[model samples]
Target: MKSKYKSIIYSIGVLLLTVGVLDKLWWLYICTIYTEFEECRVAYLSLFPERFQNAFLLTVIEILLLAVAAIIFSESKKAIYQKKASKILMIISLILFGWSVFSLM
Candidate 1:
């Protein structure tokens, strides 16, 4: 793939990953808030399937996929400077992963 195309693909992957991470955080926050209220907790869980209730697992999978995509993007880039973007993505992913883990605990 061309450099421009690679960058675009990388950006899209990053965006998707960002949205996924944010969604996980939002759901976690909502669940935490409703923990004291059993009825509200059940209602909220009912809104999503059983699989989706495990936001931590889903977010971890997303982070792994995003990391792979970033590696591919960096490898495809002709310019060395573009590799820096991958570093930024990695840092963001790590922080999000840590946040998700903390929330789970």
Candidate 2:
């Protein structure tokens, strides 16, 4: 496939993956708005272990996808463009992963 097409496909994939993970966590935070602080804290703590496991799995998948994307992009004619796009994807993925880890504490 052409680099242009590959880049677009990869970009959409990354965006969708990021949004899917964020949406899950966002709903959890949204739920806290209606609950008592103590209750919320208890619920969050109880769910932390399970949520962390899922988040870790998602993070690993994101890393693997990003690595594959990077490799594909590197072989493209537009090296600079690919580099920038990959960097942006990496940064976004890292931030999401960091947030997931922070929430565990």
Candidate 3:
């Protein structure tokens, strides 16, 4: 893929990662803090079934896609501060993976 396209994909992947993290936080808050709501413990969490709401699987996919994006971004001549960006992405990926695992148990 062209550098521009690769950059765009990376950007979109970051946006998605943000959305996923926020969604998980919202889910946590809903189930924990809002325990008074019966639906929060029952239907809402499993409304779409495991295939759709499975955190561990989704986090794995995100991390893999982010790695691809980071590789493409670093290899591009137009890349700026590639090292810093790569480190930041790596840190975020690790944190996300840890959170995903913790959520599973």
TM-score of 2: 0.41
Clashes of each: 0, 0, 0
lDDT of 1 by residue, 51-75 (tens): 7765456556656665655555455
Local accuracy of candidate 3 as per-residue lDDT tens digits, 38-60:
66754445645666675456556
| Pairs of residues clashing in candidate 2 | none
Question: Evaluated with lDDT, which candidate comes out highest?
Answer: 1
Clashing residue pairs, candidate 1?
Answer: none
Relative to the true structure, candidate 2 has a C-alpha RMSD (angstroms) of: 6.0
**Tens digits of per-residue lDDT for model 2 on 16-65?**
54664665575579576757766654554455466564544655555555
Model 2 alpha-carbon miss at residue 53, Å = 12
TM-score-superior candidate, 1 or 2: 1
Off-target runs (Cα >4 Å) in candidate 3 are 36-39, 46-82
**Backbone clash tally (model 1):** 0
Leading candidate by TM-score: 3
